[model samples]
Target: MEPGTARIAVDLLGGDDAPAVVVDGALRAVRADPDLHLLLVGPTEVAAAVTDALTPVQRARITVRPVHAAAGPAHHAPRADSTVRAAVAAVRDGTADALVSAGSTGATVSAAALGFGRWDDVRHPALVATLPAVSGPVVLLDVGGSLEPRPATLARHALLGAAYAAVAHAVAAPRVGLLSVGTEAGKGDRPRKAADPLLAAATLPCGARYVGLVEGYDLSIGARADVVVTDGFTGNVLLKAIEGAYAMAGGPPEIGGAPRAAALLGVAGTVVVCHGAAEPADVASGIALAAHLWRRRATDRVRALLAGAPAHSSPSDSIDTEVSP
Candidate 1:
């Protein structure tokens, strides 16, 4: 809260390559931002690597919460007190302002929602990501929240995406779109068919307007919409597909393509989700995003905006779990 002194709790054992990549990312983030402090949550040894790699002055900025393990074999249920849970607890307990993890999407979301609580009426929280574009920045949401999709949820996400685009990216009047197979009026499957009208009817924040349905290419080019809303299942696959496309196209375009890092919306505290397959740079960007979010207080502002808006037209009862969170 001190201007730029953003304290972030990093999950040391949350990823496929836990400890190593997570440790490396922590080192990179620490070296890049002098004002950043990290609360490393995991085994004592893993935390030591991050602490030991830094200069004495840098090491002073880090704190470790060692999580001892049981003697028995671990079960599927997240260790009752693992690094990810500790990271979430740190945010909830005011030990840290935000958290960053390249962990299981569902585990992170569940832990954050349980620890910090969700905003009123947010049944299914969304994972939102921003992509830098030539013209400006674009906000995409429901990347991996829940799958299958309800018309109402998609519409609600449109509102979330618009506010994020305006607040985080500083776009004047974002043009929102529903991702589909084509830009035509009736170009997608059943869910898109139902959600298109819902989005059209929904009220958006920050002077955003719905631009109708857009295609996958639109996401890469950012030519159709500044805020693209979709179901978590489709959005997740689409984001990965775009990343793969860029890899095939000899790296992302100059402005960049789909991002591996996403912001968790609806939870009270700031949480960043990095792809399970993130590289050191991707993890660094995730840390930067968590810092930017905590510095801007994006979570609080977005919740405030949602509080002031009228109830969404769609029902909020169904919680789609297919999208992960």
Candidate 2:
């Protein structure tokens, strides 16, 4: 392996078009990065397809862990022996620096939480996505990680987003905002109203400051805030809607389109969750993202930052009743 190499464990059977799309994507990733090493966790035959496509020097960088069981469908929970779980195990066992899966988001999140263990103060792990904006990248949290986050969870996510923006994207003194129906303090439902003051009062890491409430338009324009926090259900719906809007407009902005992948935060190890319907290029991008995070040691830095952030008190009985999109 080359120096500074990043070994990424890939779930070959994690996507809608498993094995085939994965093989193509793995090939693309390996060819694109000289310092990238992939541990394919899936059936032997499927793993062979990827290695067979590579030259002798390239094949030297590929490894395989034969896991026959695939994490099929979002409804079914991931089995202990599932490919996604095996990939997580590889990371836990120090065989891979990071893991990438295009499988069920719940299954991946569950397996990662089990294998890597959650941060002590974090109850609900957040999935953070970065969207290219007019000014710069905007970090949005809970795209699908915590569907019904309590007020405390949202506050915790604010700290996560702030640290992530600084560590992952090099944003200095990121401006953080809570996603609400309007920019006013009194707008939004029960959860938003309750969480607003908590975020404003909370001590954010990386010199981040709470910028009160922001409207939906700020997510793309990113002029108001660098980090946008929201419940998973709404964030997920908004992400897809923006992606669809980009498609309708002929193509995405010159900066880039909506990300089809997101990094899982609050877990002890590096893990990336890709869109279930991810194509080859999207899968390749996910792998690249895993490599990037591992190289930057983002997970460790974010955790360290969170450790220094002050804890906030929230009502345990608080609940959000918003419908999923």
Candidate 3:
């Protein structure tokens, strides 16, 4: 309703906690952003509970699309009438500007790709998350996108990550790095070794340059490389490890901590995927993330940038690796 309003579709059945956590998070996001609108997609009673919590004026911004489907765990492939698909449809039908779901990562990714379509020439859809680093923020990719990305896949992620840092975080001429066991070019496994040369020669948009191999420490400290590239297996493991480390050391730093939510890049629409075990606060943040992405038109810009970026290799050169959502 407001000039900068962002209508986000909430998958009420998505998340480990389901309707309750989703409801609580929707309430939090609506109260936090007056310009934010929500389309609650789930059972009527759940949607009612969300609307009931808001004031009359606030309720005006809420829209409800009652869906009837038993949402299985996140790992369950989406059923035909699942809430996540309904949420995606809302965005595609212009009822919402973005979508946020804590459902199974794979389900969300599949639904999004099928609904929004992957950008032409995109080998795989990438999940990107920004973590608070000692120096600043570090953008990490394939947090759950392509798990066993080949050299070409990593190269593609490098370009996507670089463009994201420049557009979403405003990092200028970002330094890009491939995550490896050591800083030496030949230190990593076969994937890393093979990917190194490909990334070295790839052309990154927005003045970004490849910084060669970066150790895992570089991901947290942010002293080197604005963008850290890795397969989802390593990236996801590293992300949880960093989160655990931060948890052990009192709490996350004030500058903002590792986000539990990640933006699904390479999709045609704005979609934010929260950790399946996301708490209410995490869900709220996911909603906020969706709104921010939609408001900034980050997805469209990233796609446009990818369109202009020179191909590192032909589609045949990359293998479509499946990592968990």
Best by TM-score: 2
Estimate the lDDT of model 3. 0.88
lDDT for each residue of candidate 3 in 1-325, tens digit (9 for 90 to 100): 2249899999998877887888999999999999999999999999999999999999999999989884465566688798989999999999999999998899999889889998987656999999988777899998988677577788889999999999888899999999998997699887888788888878899999999999888987899999999988888888898889889998888887778999999889999999988888999999998998888888999889999987545642744344546
How well is each residue in 52-144 modelled by candidate 1, as lDDT tens digits?
A: 899999998999888754112222435567677788888988999899888788778777877889888887689998876666787888898
Would you list the clashing residue pairs of candidate 1? 147-323
Candidate lDDT values, in order:
0.82, 0.90, 0.88
Candidate number with greatest lDDT = 2
What's the TM-score of each model vs. the native? Answer: 0.91, 0.94, 0.94
Backbone steric clashes in candidate 3, count: 1
Model 2 local distance difference test score: 0.90
Error of 3 at 191 (Å): 0.8
Better candidate by TM-score, 2 or 3: 2
RMSD of 1: 3.3
- Which pairs, if any, clash in model 3? 74-104
> Per-residue lDDT tens digits of candidate 2, residues 128-214?
999999999999998989888567778888999999999999999999999999997799988888889888888899999999999
